[model samples]
Target chain A: MGELYRLRRKIEQIIKDGNLDEHQTKGKITLECGLLLALINENTPDEVNALRKLKTAAEKLLGNF
Target chain B: MKMNSLKLKLISLVMACMLANALIIAWLLLDSFQREKNTLAWQALQGAQETYVHLEENCTRTLSATLAALLADEKIAALYQQRDRDKLYRYTAPLFEILKNDFQVTHWYFLEPETAAPAIAQKCFLRVHNAALYGDVVNRVTYKNAVQTKTFSSGKELGKTAFALRVVHPYYHQGTLIGYMELGQEIDEFLSTMQKMTGDAFALIIDKRYLDQTEWKNVRNRKNLPQNWDDMKDAVLINDVLPNKEITRFEGEIEKIPAAGQILEEKQLGKSLYMKGILPVYDAAQRKVGGILILHDITKINSNMKRTLLYSAVSIFVLTLVLGGLIVFVLNRLVFKRLDQMNQTAIRVVGGDYNTKIVPTADDELGQFETLFEQFRNVFVNAVSGIENAESKTIKTKRPVKKRKPRRKP
Candidate 1:
């Protein structure tokens, strides 16, 4: 058991070192796309377009109403 | 979201991605099925409209012909005899004989122009009548727009209310006006035909508030049944969407109420609906006054999907178990096995077991470990050998010096 403990610790240390290298290349820390994607999901589709149209129509109608 | 170690975090992330992908795929499939159900429900409604339109047109044509024939017939003309109080019972008997019996309208009465009192030839009294002047009724009708069923009472137990659309045909003779004929048929069987066509699907003849006026019959799980869907699914019949009326989709979660009419009305929630299909209930002139809402309950579909996911999860668990076994096995063979070998070698070297050497196999990180262990072994063996050699040389040199000192002393 004592011998097993020693070996396990050594192996664990090696794995930690390898993980640090992996994170440097493929970390969530590097990408700036998550927030944008989240934004797109919360709003209704075509609703913005409809509002934009309403705004433009209001402008036109005011010029003529 | 918090993970234990880097390895654990990585594995958990991969597993999370797999679960998310599975969930997304399941959601997409559910959405597609929902769309298909909506389409099917719409087609069924269209089919019902076509059938009724055909039947109504047929009945109208046949009744118009019968009315014409009655006007020309010798027997009816003789009965047009009573001039002082012309009770239209004679006109109605022939109308019933010709229109009601054959054409499927149970109530056929000549609505008088001055008085809307149903002149029943059979009883000479109104059968189902709120008898008033036809002109007054028409004026009220014109004001109200299209004809419809009005709820005389409230709640669920009052059976159903009565309202009728008028079919006005003026009866003229020589140079005088006789009266206007008002034709109305209780559309029970016509609606029944619609119910029949919509097998296993929910069909409703909704009234002014979009509440169901027809008998609630729903099809559930492809089962052939007279499903009493008084309160089946959590749905909302979107009505009052007039061409000019401003209304929203009542964005929110549908309340947990079993009936379809109840709404949660909270803007933050999404309505979990199985289907939403609406078709306008047309007037006799084929005008859109109100519509029928045919909704297919997809709650069972959702539950079945959940069950399918559960099944998929179990299968995925099994697959992952196998994959986990493979990973463990491969790790044991390539990584842990090498590690165990290196561990034993390390134990030997640490235990002062000199001359212990590990033949390096794959040139990996473990190979570097083996190289390190080999160097330690060489240093240990050389240090032990040099100590033994030094001790022997000191003993030999001391013995020769002792012999020379003894000889000189003698």
Candidate 2:
């Protein structure tokens, strides 16, 4: 529902489609974005900085920029 | 692996050090070998000079004793006092032949005393070796020294065409000086004898300044030998025992050669290597008139040195290879491989596999890092779990009551 959650979902789908190691891929994205992907939900505020960080991390980790 | 890797860099540094050391060792070995060659050449020169002196001394003693024995003959003194050249020759010719055959004596001379009178200026009374070449003035240094001192004189003197070790004794009969009796042997035989004694080649070079080119050419021609006056500049090769005459070629000033000797450049003749040198040859007047070129064979030693250097190079190369391999193996086993393991463990922990603990394999530095990372992973897992629980409780509290409006309508 939130922009950050949407970016997180896109990263998850890319990892699944690529059949990459799930924990390793998510952990890489978490370290790069400095946020936990599993905790991202609809209640999360779609702050401009958070959204930008999520998009950049997803782009770097999953090529989903 | 990348070239910039630590392992490759360390190996490159080690290899560079080893290469530098090998080059230094090779340079030292070559320098030592060169010094050894020069020393051998110098020793050969010294040995040749000593042999020449010893032979000359022996010849002087033998000729002195023979002349002493000849002077005991009353008839020899009587014939010389009467100035009878034919009787003196007839008397001493047989004795001269015996002396030549027995003691290697080659020249026998009888001379008249120096006089200021012009009518008797011919000082050469009789030459037993050359009966036809008489009535000539004896102007040799040995003759002059003997006449001037009125005593025994002996030294090596260079003649018009040859070098002879002559021993001249002032002849005195009944308290009056009669003349000089001299005995000599050609010094050409000294070169051959020295060659035989030392198993090295020798060449006698007389400077053109001290020699008559025409006389040298004539003697060479008479001996059926090649005229060698043009073979060299400023000097002529009088005699040589070298298999190849080209080895005697020298271009430097003969007078500049040191008195003790000088080592020359090494020469390669076909399959053989030779160390050449020069020893100054002095005449009775103590003039440095020539040099004796000495060539010593050093092929075996040179080949041995090269073989030793090859062996050393191969040994160093093999040692470097073995050492490099061992270093790489130890580095990989102790550092790179363990660091790679730590890298993989960190990636898995970042992927949320917190249960997989980073167990330290040793008590070393890497092990200490692993223990610290494991403790951090535990804290991160606990913190994430606490966040998840807080989020679940907030969701439950925010849930809306179900069907409350429907119950009110009923």
Best by DockQ: 2
Clashing pairs in 2: A23-B351
Each prediction's TM-score versus the true structure: 0.48, 0.88
lDDT of 1 by residue, B201-236 (tens): 333333333234343222222345433333223323
Error at B202, model 2, angstroms? 0.8
TM-score of 2: 0.88
Candidate 1 chain B lowest-lDDT run of ten: B150-159
Which of the numbered candidates is closest to the native, going by highest lDDT?
Answer: 2
Off by over 4 Å in 1: A1-65, B1-88, B106-137, B140-161, B170-180, B200-307, B363-410
lDDT of each: 0.42, 0.84
Candidate 1: lDDT over CA atoms?
0.42
